[model samples]
Target chain A: MEAIIPVIITSVCVYGLFRRINIFDSFVEGVKEGFGTVRFVAPTMIALLVAVGTLRASGFLDFIAELISPLAESVGFPAELVPMGLLRPVSGSGATALLTGIYRDCGPDSFAGRCASVVAGSTETTFYAVTMYYGAAGIKKIRHTLFSALLADLTAIIVSVITVGLLMS
Target chain B: MSYIFGVMIALGFIYALVSGNMAALSAGIPEAAASAVELLISISGMLCMWSGFMRIAKDCGLTEKLARLLAPLLRRLYPDIDPDSKAFGYISVNISANLLGLGNAATPPGLNAMRELRKRSGTEIASDSMITFVVMNTASIQLVPATVAALRKSYGSTQPFDIIICVWITSAVALAVGLMSSRLISALTRRGRIWKR
Candidate 1:
């Protein structure tokens, strides 16, 4: 994997230069653009982070998790995995924090940790990503996009969790 | 916000530790820290790779070629959009980026696409083309899903590739639903001659 990284980088650089762009300039431009995006997206990202944090700290997350535990268990999902589902769509970092908690509490190889891992693997930060990208772009209408992406996120979580549970177990 | 939660968790652990809840704190902090590190690594890695890839793709003329290749399909999908318009190009790139499972990488392009779309949209609150673009972006099909694979690897999963089937299935379903609903809504408005007037 380490060896492949250089090869991929070199190939990409070579291809870039071949297209009339100076590799150095392209790198600089890319970085500049990235920083610009971070600036544009920072407020929303921070707000989401704080909101998720507040919820978790206030025990709202735990309460919701507990409420959903029974339904989760009926579907073979560990009750602890509920936090992961709730967190997945909101913020990737937030979900990772929750997953880490589960892994620590339940043991990495345990069903709950495994489910969290799978859920992390399958899901996308649908709402957050869309909001940040579209908001920056000044897009006022998303039509069916949010609903569709969310459906994908939900499906990915449920299917991945169940599949991993069955296979890993 | 979630940072507060992390702080709270840390405080709770501290409280637990002082209260002889050593086991809880001992178990929690390390896990939380590990997950935070993993998240940071994944996001940074993805951002780096995608930014680099986009630069390379643009320099290679791949971005334009990609736009050309996608033009026919895009025209069909977004008939209200002018073929020669910037919105068409941006929409094409955005859709392509999503399809490649480079949604994170696609962010820059998606934003650029939306800006171009907005410019072409005039003063309309939400043009038909803009709405379709949004719907497409939201329902963007992902074929690669590198972020998920990275997360799986971080979690010590041996079979990260197993997620491919599930990702494909779910993205496909979502895309179908998104496109159908948007088209239906657009058709209803057209028949009512609401936007036509």
Candidate 2:
């Protein structure tokens, strides 16, 4: 299944040549456009990247993590995982680090670690995708992208909680 | 986002001063920028490769085939987009690749699809289709969270895909709800209804 993308690309190339399309020319055209887009979005991406890094490093994420465990302490999830759920959408690497850290600290079979695993898998970097796509697409008015993405992330979090409750218990 | 960046930096600075991790905070700024650059460099390759394939696919009417397949669902979602446009092809690729948990490959096609949607939009403001496309891409319901599978494997899980049902259900719910919210908001906010042809 992982090979599907490569297979798709190769077949497209072969099909392009079979159709007598200048595959090289079209490839170059696409590359040029991609380069232009990268240049255009670099600043916005940088802004997001830097913000994500600082948000993680500044202990703010830790603070949020601390705040979450008490709210639902009855379920008995570890406080260590709250950061993983919150940060997954803001930053992937941060969440991965958090996931591994939680696994190491709490043991992968622990309820907290299981919750982290499910939560991490269930969500995407909603804001990051939103930022990159909007920047690349050059749509100034972002409209409901952020709201919708966050709502999805929230849903992912809620569903993760439920899944863990069902499977881990 | 700029405001968020500023706030983050300011918070970082204040936290560093209060916590005496100023050196670490200062050091992390440049490192973050560098990593962001590295990310773009790698993503640029993915973007170029998939965009080129999309071009090839478009030339061969493969996208039209995809469009035909997804039209019933997407047509109502993207009323502004022409039925025959190549955007549908890329959109289909984006949707499928994401569902299969091909995150990296899903992106270039996603970017391609968004670019096409943006072209159709033609205004600074996002159109309904563009907004919906972004929402779908953002919450591209994966059947398998491949990254999570790898993580589970490394942690010595007997079965890595145990989370598959969970991810599938969660993402499906997220996608459905997100698209509706985005569409509803877009409609509510549509005052001028400008589509530059």
Candidate 3:
């Protein structure tokens, strides 16, 4: 797994050499463009992080998770993972924090911990993805992307719990 | 974006007032800003390196070659796009990078692809292909989630990779559901004039 990146870099460099391209110069050019990309996304990132952070700190996320906990438990999902699932799509850092908390409270090898790991691994931060991608194009009307992405996230969360239960036990 | 943030902030403020959690919310605002900067610092290096490599790849025609290899699938996903265009090339490589678990590397190509798509459509609203591409990305289609495995190992899991199969199952299911729903909703809304910009 670690070797994949080195392998890709080497292959790309070798191919660049074969094509007689100025690899270093081309790389520098791309890096400069990357700086612009970062600048472009800075506002979106800051705004999203602040909103998510405030919601998380104010306990609204836990509130929503608690509100949905019964429905989740009725469906066989663990209560502890409900918050993680709710935050998974909206905030990557918040979800990771919850995952770590789960690891501390329930040992990492426990059902809840394993389920959290699988859920985190399987789900993308859909809010971030949608915002960054569409924001880049200056597209305001995202239509159904958010709905579909959240639906996918829900599927992943449910499937992760079920799969972990099936395999772990 | 505006609606999401507006509602979120409103909820946070109201909840804080109701629960007397105003201190935490007040402190969290600046902390979130700092964390956002930290996040950017962490990812900026990979973003630069990958973007640089991508530039080299484009210069050497590797992206074009890769695009050609994935032409069949790309054609199906983005039927309106010409396979030889720059947008097609970026989209193909972006998906490839995401599948390989190169999350940071995928963003440059993704952003570039969005630019190209927007330019082609000449509109501020997202086109069908744009939504499909973003949805595909948001499905978390990685083959091996290295970060999760490493975190598990750090937490003393002897078999960190054991969940790989489960991860694969969940992600694949998510991707399938997301794509299907995206297509379904798009079709349903196409005739109704319901999805106003």
Candidate 4:
């Protein structure tokens, strides 16, 4: 696992050399453009992070989780994992923090721990990805993207619990 | 996007107002701004490295070869982009990096792919292909879920990889749902002729 990236890098350079591609110049050019890409992505990311942070700090996430608890429970989903499921699609770091907390509170071998791991492992930060990709491309009207992404995120969370229950337990 | 962001902030601020958590909310704003910089600082290095290597790969025809190999399948999803084009090549590399659980490494190719798609479409509104691409990414398509496994291992789980099968199941389902919903909504929007953009 550790050797994979280095091997790929070396192979790309070697391949470039064999093809007479001037890998150094190519690399430098890409890096220069990457600097601009970072600059382009920063403002949206900062604004997004603050929005998510505000939501979390205001305890709205907990409120939403509580509101959804009965529905989650009726589906056999553990209430403890609701906050995690809610946060998974919005904030990657927040989901990770919740996942870690689950591991600590329930131990990784427990049902909630297993479910949390599956949830964390299977759900991407839909909001962040949509924002970054669309924002970078200067696309303002995202249309059905957020709708579709949230649907997928919901699927991941629901299926995580089901699959974990079936396989891990 | 504005509506979502605005709703998030507005609802949060309103909740804080009603619940009297304004101090914590105010503190989180700057903290999140700072963390955004921290996140960028961590990702930029890897982003540069991967983008550089990707450029080398592209120059040497590696990405083109990979794109050709993946084209039959990718073509079905992204019919707008020509199989042999740079956009397709970047899309192929992005998906491959994502499958390998190289999330940071995937971003450069993903962004390049988006840019290429945007250029090809020449539209400010996202095309079906771009929507499809972003949905695929947001579905957690990684095969191994390496970070999750590593976290489990660090927490003393003996069989960290045990959840690999479950991850696979959930990812495939999520991706399927995402793609299908996007396609469905796209068809509906087109039929209704509600494409204001």
lDDT tens digits by residue: candidate 4, A25-134: 99998677666667877777677767767887897867876788798788788776877787778767657655755665578778888888887888898888999999
In angstroms, the error of model 4 at A96 is 0.5
Once model 3 is optimally superposed onto the true structure by TM-score, how far is the C-alpha of residue A154 displaced, in angstroms?
0.9
The lDDT per prediction is 0.60, 0.69, 0.80, 0.79
True contacts kept of each: 0.21, 0.65, 0.79, 0.79
Q: On residues B1-197, what C-alpha lDDT tens digit does candidate 1 reach at each position?
A: 55655664565544554455566445544544444544555455545555655666555666567678988988898887788876666677777766644455567767776677667665525566665666556443655455445545555656544545545555565556656766677677678786567
TM-score of each: 0.65, 0.63, 0.67, 0.66
lDDT by residue for model 1 over A4-88, one digit each (tens)? 4356567668877676677777766665654554455545444444434434444445666679888877867678876677667
Order of quality (TM-score): 3, 4, 1, 2
Kindly report the root-mean-square deviation of model 1 from the true structure over all alpha carbons.
6.2
| Candidate 3 residue A126 C-alpha distance from true site, Å | 1.5
Q: Give the best candidate by DockQ.
A: 3
Quick one: best lDDT, which candidate? Answer: 3
The CAPRI quality class of candidate 1 comes to acceptable
lDDT of 1: 0.60
- Over all chains combined, what TM-score does candidate 4 have? 0.66
Off by over 4 Å in 1: A1-67, A76-81, A100-124, A133-149, A158-169, B2-23, B38-59, B101-105, B139-142, B188-197
Please give, for every candidate in the order listed, the TM-score of chain B alone compared with the true chain B: 0.69, 0.60, 0.65, 0.65
Per-candidate clash tally: 6, 0, 0, 0
lDDT of 4 by residue, B93-164 (tens): 888767655566689999999999899888899999999999988888765565566567666777766777
